[model samples]
Target: MYLTIPVLVLLVDLSFEKEYLSWKLLTTKVVFGQAVQLRCHLPKQNCCHNYTRSWRGGPDYTLLTLNEKSSNYTKYIEYLDTESRTSVLTIKSFSESEVDIIYQCSYGFSSYEAILQLTRHRYEFHPTESVPVSLSFNGTHMYAKISLEKVFPKPQCYGNTNEKDITKESLKVISKRNGIFYKSMIDFNYMIDPQHCFGLVTITCTVGTSRITIAEQNTSCRKNGSTFHGKHLAQRDSVASNSHDEESNIVGKVLIVLCFHFFNGL
Candidate 1:
């Protein structure tokens, strides 16, 4: 007896782009050495005939089909339902070179493009250490400032002394290049009556697991009060939470290998 194997092909309607079609590629701040998954689909359309569904991008013009796993760190999966079809692209381990680049998913003759961007501290092109921390005083209040550029996720800033909480505000500027510009400031009145204490003002911002900190010690305060130390201020402003208006844009660049190999006899 002879056995036959069926090739699992995706039956995509060429007209899937019409009448409530939804196709998008998305991901969060892709950290180096972490896994990332991007989902793509066209809503409200189902076909009975198998067409071509593939992904095009990465090093060596990666062309991946449904259920295919690339030699690199990429893989593709496809799903079908009664009303729509879904395709997902997953990178086993995201890297720095893959940041800020375009990847495409093609169904039949239609395709959509998407780009993945790194958080502030992950992009080697614009190192996070390049930004400087600022500290100053106005004779009445001690002020500390921390600024970061190309930050994708919203940042939380804190100003603290003696490990106690203080007043701090954060701001994020909208931009289209890599991410957003984040700046935070902390203010403390060191001239309280009957007690004057000032020692260290530490400024810090955290986005996901990445954090940046700045501290200035021995600030001018009366020598009679308790010394203020550095601590993360648990505070965020409305500006930082609402500054992301647009997604990062992708440009064609060097190849970061992503291959799609379809499962045989599907």
Candidate 2:
């Protein structure tokens, strides 16, 4: 279920050709939970000052920075190829939320971008124990969010009923990349089953191309003071148990406002 996004290529004119970098392809694509390889060919330069190697994504955020001759990368592996005059980036396994992003390589004065898109497989999309995804209620409405590097194409959420039909809803993508790497946030309004009496609620979260996570937790809606709890999800045996009646959408709409106050005493 991997989906590819079209990439935009930008050109720059250099009077001196020493700072040019070339890409093997316009875009680099990989399936979710898989590895990928990227090559950034470098041009010979006569400058005395050394050029730095770094990876850029989402505005000016730098995902990784290192000397081309470094021994090893912490998360992924990289190597400087002297034979082909190229810099390589290799991801052994991609489990991060931010996979759909524009990744660029910078070596001193030369920089170029290669679109990176990761898609889920047809069957599985849930974040494993290593990566956690949550869908919980914040009193008034249910919000779903995941901690990822980026949410490309953005994720769409939906609700399911006993009849097996699902309805799609809008999902919002939020990012917290200050000037370095991004810790993206994606939230959305959770739709509920109209027949909340006995029918189950299957909450499925999907990014642009494929699924992310799907769960069927027994949650009850509140008419007045109901609370929605979405602890971190587990791939298997994901059960949030409560014997109380399930709350309806009407009852969970009670509104309340508060202020931030520093407590003088415990």
TM accuracy, model 1: 0.42
Predictions in order: lDDT = 0.48, 0.51
Q: What is the C-alpha lDDT profile of model 1 across 1-266, one tens digit per residue?
A: 12322222223334436333334544545554566666667443444135466666654456644434444444434444434466666765555555567777765556777665444544322224544355666655554434344444555555566575553332222233443333333332333233646566665556555666644445655654223321112223444444442211121121221222233323
Task: Candidate 1: count the clashes.
Answer: 9
Top TM-score: which candidate number?
1
Once fitted onto the true fold, the runs of candidate 1 whose alpha carbons sit more than 4 angstroms away are 1-22, 28-33, 43-49, 59-61, 64-66, 74-84, 114-158, 162-201, 206-266
> What is the Cα-based lDDT of residue 247 in candidate 1?
19
- TM-score of every model? 0.42, 0.34
- Residue 264 of model 1: what lDDT? 36
Summarize candidate 2's per-residue lDDT along 51-149 as a digit string, tens digits.
Answer: 677655533345654654333364455567776667777755554444556777777767787665443322123333343344565544455545555
Q: Which residues of candidate 2, in runs, are more than 4 Å off?
A: 1-20, 23-38, 43-68, 80-85, 91-153, 166-200, 217-266
